[model samples]
Target: MTVLPEWPAGTVAVLSTGAGAPHAIPVSTAIRRGDTQLAFALALRRESLVRLREDPRCAVVLLAAGLAITVHGRAVVERELERIAVVRVDVESIQDHQSPRFEIDAGVAWHWTSEEAQSGDAETRAAVSQP
Candidate 1:
């Protein structure tokens, strides 16, 4: 089993799948549930959710300062909320993509433009963090 390392605050995660022509999306609420498990929340209207439902095989690329890790896993919808769905990924393999040539100064930064959206994101993150 692959063990996940501790992710820094503000780390960015991109969830991807090969369901059809390769689909990927940046997920902001991703968090490590355990050494070999990860969880994140996705909006119900997201197309990536549909693809995940069709095919659970997926991967999450986590990027942070001076670190890049790719986690291969199978995803399953764990809970359905009013506006979002909590998905859990059971890790299969972890690959460190960081190199000695260069260093990543920072991870991707994103901000919510609306207060309502920001509040919703906080709620989603809280929900995903629950046991």
Candidate 2:
């Protein structure tokens, strides 16, 4: 197995699903498992989750902390909790898209506007972290 580059927790990434048009969404809960696997949780009602259920093929784009790469893989629904679906991606390829012309200084910033949402996010992250 190919070990993937280590990315920090909460590293901003875009999860792309589907085949033709490709539905993409910003995901902040992505976590690296060991070396070759990445995992994230999505709300059960999210259309992206539905699309992923239909097509396991997906890609995660990361452009943060001076790194720019696209991780392509196949996703599998590992489990489902009360309100979120935990998905694990078995990484197949890591394509570097970095250029010397420019450098990335930081990752996408995110803030919660409501305490309820923040609490829920924390719970989701905890669930995703479980074995």
| lDDT score of residue 17 within candidate 1 | 84
Per-residue lDDT tens digits of candidate 1, residues 1-131?
26798786446799998779899998888899889999998989998899999999999999888768999999999989998899999999999887889887888987889999888777888999885
Best of the candidates, TM-score: 1
lDDT of each: 0.87, 0.86
User: TM-score of the candidate numbered 1?
Assistant: 0.91
Backbone-clash count (model 2): 0
TM-scores for the candidates? 0.91, 0.90
Per-residue lDDT value at 70 in model 2: 90
Q: In model 1, where do residues sit more than 4 Å from their true spots?
A: none
Instruction: Please give the range of 10 consecutive residues that has the lowest summed lDDT in model 1.
Output: 1-10
Q: Cα lDDT of model 2 overall?
A: 0.86
